[model samples]
Target: MKKPLVLIVDDEPDICELLEITLNRMDIQTYTAENIRTAKALLQQKHFELCLTDMKLPDGNGLDLIDTIQASPNPIPVAVITAHGNMDTAILAMKKGAFDFISKPVDLAVLRQLINSALKLSDPVVTKERRIRHELLGESLSMWEIRSKIDKVARSQAPVLISGESGSGKELVARLIHQQSSRSDHSFVAINCGAIPLELMESEFFGHKRGSFTGAVTEKKGLFQAAEGGTLFLDEVADLPLPLQVKLLRAIQEKKIRPIGEHQEIPVDIRLLSATHRNLAEMVQTGSFRQDLFYRINVIDLHIPPLRDRKADIPALTEHILVKLSAVNKIRPPALSKTALAALQQYHFPGNVRELENILERALALYDGKIIEYDDLNLPISTHNKLNCPEYAPDFGSLEDYLEKIERKAIILALKENKRDKAAAAKQLGLSVRSFSYRLKKLNLDS
Candidate 1:
């Protein structure tokens, strides 16, 4: 793997040398410049994962670099170095698109942490790509159903609400919707409602004009405006505060936004998609979520199924992840033994698809290019024990009753795992078309 590069811009030679030495020890390559012009030239010549610049420069202010970086084709995260009393300027730097700012006489440990975090944020596309490459590996009925739903929902502009346990591919669904929409030609902007700090929430969603607040030194476009003519994906929408929820509702309803410290509303032509792992209806009932907003955003809903419910898809999913991971790691693919596959199928994945991917990754790390045996798969003992337990099992008076109970449980689990794929469930259980129909009807589990 290539080492991440850092660009340090400061007039002080000693500081530059110190940072270069410190970062090089951590295996990070460093580039140093004394002024804004040299820094910009270097930035243009080569891409740096991150940039740290002093607020005071000989030719120009470091805040000016923020605008330049944002305008660049490949924007490098920039952090402002400010004096103790220059906190106001540092805050201004952040508002102007600086990833973060540090006070002068920087603590090496704190600076290192900030640099590492910023590098990760600077290249989210890579992480997103890695995630997608890991998904879509299942061949079960539930997997096919999810694929079908993605296809169906992608064809519409209706607002979609995706609900699932964490790691169940809610964001992946959102991305698929954006990719298939009429606005696919435009940007697909995603924001985590719960992750934004309460104080910065407004600025993040509605943006701010220059001089809007203590740190607002320049006009900035929020995610909504940034996603104009495209799709705006609001992840964890249920986490949005009640007050901000009203503002978001107005934006969705009116198709306009008024930036902070600005009088006029900017008209936005965009498709809105929101996802939440939380139960919005429950939150609404508890008076935590606004009923009006929920109704507005949930014009269409998509629920992702957990992995355990779609056990039939386990074989395909395992093979898919293994192939993808092999390609990425540039290694020969390992085979999954039948016993190993059975082990995976029997396990209850509380984290859903995400958990399965993680387990597979661990298996790959230990496989040594050999077939993954049951012993090679280090699954929890509890999972295997549950599969063998008979004492607490169901007792049916007749074969019909036993089959009925099994069918009901399978259907319910399928719906939950495949995010509710009727056809997939029927296929997985090896039932005839009419037989599955009758079972669903008898059980009153048909949706």
Candidate 2:
């Protein structure tokens, strides 16, 4: 809803006025500065979507401004205006963080195009900040680890495989990766492998020529092609069919794709990042997933632990989610009663972080600005007793008795839920399979 602001900096008043008029005609708000000092002052005081400055300023070189801008918290996309035959300076400008360089006799059309592109780059950062303010609001160790991984991974072009339970913030992680990557200047394409029908998978991945299929009334670019220099996040990647997996493997290996009905393979420079809730190793063992393809994508594995494993982060996560929901709904954030907080801390989030967000959102809507009490949480009452397990609660009985009861309950629940699959239950319980067998032996439940 806000028009982009463009700052035009030139030593010559006429040049600044001309560009201001042009930008104003395009419905972009303009700010004019006649020197580097004034430009820097304006930049510090206000946020401009894009900046156009002369390569040579009265007090300092435009290159100096580029360095200063790049060091700022939110740097504006900069374009250097240089004299004709100053190609060397132009190159240097770009190297110093200038988005583009324009010649002295500026062609208004070219200048407009460059400004337009620079403004477009600002959109992603703006959109990302808003989304973070809305969706991401936690500082838990698990959340912090994820943020740290995103920051580190964004600097490289490696293929990342994010494995987490459903509703565990996979998409948010993908977005952060894209936002922090070198290819942040390009588009980020995301697709859910499980949501697309098998018959349309090829068309969706490689796009299609007009008239190639029944619904192909026009030529379309596939997700891979659209994300050419950026990232392609394949959500629910385990759902990709076996046949498509082969094609995808080849594409990743060769760095190209052959669109449906096309002869020549189009070269693509995509950074692939895939996520799935399913156990990939188990899938591979069962022949449901390609082992080679798994190796290709699992170059850098980032496992987002389930929320239950990171219960220490619940308070921060709860507050963050509540604030975000309030901002989105245009209402004041509701208060969480101590009883409600205690109840939430006790529950094992089977759905993980996503379930926690949903629960908070539901509570906000249900309570409608009122204080959220324990009853308002609507979690299983049994969860409260589970929280009172001796690990967190003060011991009232012999240590041996507490340990036996906790172990018995955990084993029974794991066995029942895993349908007596001891190995699988062991993994869920974070125990070695052999140790689980010994536990069954000790409990006399081996039969």
Candidate 3:
């Protein structure tokens, strides 16, 4: 088998010698260049699997070399070595199409990991795309564009901030990116940032050594350690506390973490992916979120459009949901009546794809024979009372179950009307604040 070829571009002879020695020890071939002019010549002359260039070059900068490589017909993966403590340059290089970036006074371990990941993109077997379209579940132009964007961004090490409404499959999108990336073989660790206790946030993220604190009877690895050489997805990242956000920004910027009770900082090799339904820009303006942290995580924003905008895909989405529900219920997949399909498309989906699934699953249970009608959907009524039709009454489901559905829809409607203000929504519904909060938890709408 032919060894992988790497192009090492740097003006310093000592740095070039070090990189050449490192690659040679790893059973890889290396071609050296002193500056951008020499690197471009080498790039045109040889087919290299990966290229590593210092940020500073006597003739030109690394960004120039990156641009030249990307403009070529067949662009191999490129990485930039930035000066220590200069995260802005690293981020800029990554945005300019560098596959990854490593800090100067380089850590050889991290460099090895970065090179391996870049090389994986050149390996046909490891680089094959993971078919994840079925999980996305829409055929609109927006969905198509999202799929294309995912393909492009999966090749980079930049932090991707997935923006979408609740239940719009933000985590699913993150998982897809991880699965299709060079880090696919490693773990894809996901955690809801809002779900963790405030006191334990630091320990949960950076881990703690034995006897680190009251609960530190045993040493535990944090999400970063667990997701080493893979991806760590922080869902609902906007909910993080201000203090934790500062620590998080440092970890991401430095690519190193100091677990609680540990004296030395440890180098961590992992990709960061975050998501939120909230408007982070607004949060930043209000001083609720750290601006530096926001910039670090939101290198690239991928927005998944809500279902209402893609109503044309409703019929197909409903069919897909019904099939899954049928399999779980041990029943044949039911067909939706034409009227039912139209009713779904006409209604606005505040909870996005998640609500659609819930409505369909509930309808499938009470629906008789194989066809689900409009009434079975139990869609929330509008201010004008659209369900006033005499035929809208269906008596198949029990009173208890029917009432629960009514309660869920009524609460959803109230929340939507009041802009999700629990206090105002409770007053509008003639319920106490505590009761409203309870109802939200009971209806599984608190998230």
Candidate 4:
């Protein structure tokens, strides 16, 4: 059996030797490259399980090499080595497709952990299967960028705060992080903080002894206990009462929880991932949420782009949702006509992905045929069309006619204000350039 090979690119001979020794101790083979050119040559010559490169290479920087490697047919997962205080550079590298990063004067334990996670992606079958299982199902630029961020965030034990509108798949993102992390085999316990009553919040989060309270008929574990060695995802976490927030902060900070009515605190090992549609920072300012707790859980932030922002992904999302609906209903998946898909793409999705799912489910139930048509969607067109309607219109007409007049007048006014700078006008109107251009064509304002 061939050993897993690692390519280490560093101009420093001592650091290269040290890394080779460390990796060899783990039964991994290493190839050394003193510069970007050597690293590129080595990469072309053979397959490597992972690559570790210093940020400043003698020939070129790591970011340049990363970009080059990504364009190649077979891209290897690469981790960067940055100066101890150079976290900004490390984050930039992560955004540019670096698997992970380690600070200089490196801790061997941290290096080993990074290596292990990178190795997981080296296996083709495991990587492919995992990507499919935890798929975000979008091809838009925003979706691609978010997936990259998720991959980087998954390898660490840091608390992640995901913010997005309701029904935007925040929980799915949390589940993906858990699935991709080392805790994949362990339980993924998710709870809606808003749904739990204030009275039961403590008992639900921390286990209680039998007869601890009136409802405590038997000894039961709480979410923390159930999520031991795994992940605890607090969905709608902003809604957690301020009083309970203090206890939650203590538990997260100490990694120990005292059950309700229990005298001792038990240790827990779990990663915390939290999500909320509300503005937590604003909540903190209003004294509705604890600032200390917010800082603790928001170590890293992941914002999911709402569906309307990534309209290009509508077709793929529609198809994926239809397939799921088909499997659950034990029927053949229905195809959407071009007109129906166009309608979906044109409308704003205020409810995000969840709304799309609901729309498809409704279409599947109501439409008896194998193909879903434009009318089958039963989408509310008037709402989106009238989104920017003026407060007063001189001429009363049908909603469609009124929307047309309002849209044309708004476009003309915006164009005149921005001196016909379509991009600037689009920005002022809070519309994407594509959407603005499409509207101009639809309303005969292109002239």
For each candidate in the order shown, give its overall lDDT on alpha carbons: 0.75, 0.78, 0.87, 0.83
Q: Which stretches of candidate 4 lie over 4 Å from their true place?
A: 1-134, 368-370, 387-447
Instruction: Give residue 82's error in model 4 in angstroms.
Output: 19
lDDT tens per residue, model 1, 291-402: 8888767766777777777777777777778888889999888898765776677777777777888888888888757787654566643443532211222233466764
Writing each residue's lDDT as its tens digit, candidate 2 over 19-105 gives 988899989999988888998899988889888899788898989988998898777678888897565676566656576667767
Going through the candidates in the order shown, the clash numbers are 1, 0, 0, 0
Per-residue CA lDDT of model 4 for 176-281, tens digit only, reads: 9988876676799999998998898989999899999898999988999999877999999988998899999878755579998789988777779999999999
State the lDDT of candidate 3 residue by residue for 83-182, as single tens digits.
8988888888888888988888988988898888898888988865554444666778888888888887888899999999998889989998998889
Judge candidate 1 at residue 145 and give its lDDT: 77
lDDT, residue 407, candidate 1: 57
Better candidate by TM-score, 3 or 4: 3
TM-score of 4: 0.61
Per-prediction TM-score: 0.56, 0.57, 0.84, 0.61
Clashing pairs in 4: none
* Runs with alpha carbons beyond 4 Å of true place in candidate 2: 1-137, 213-215, 368-370, 381-447
Ranking of all predicted structures according to lDDT, beginning with the best and ending with the worst: 3, 4, 2, 1
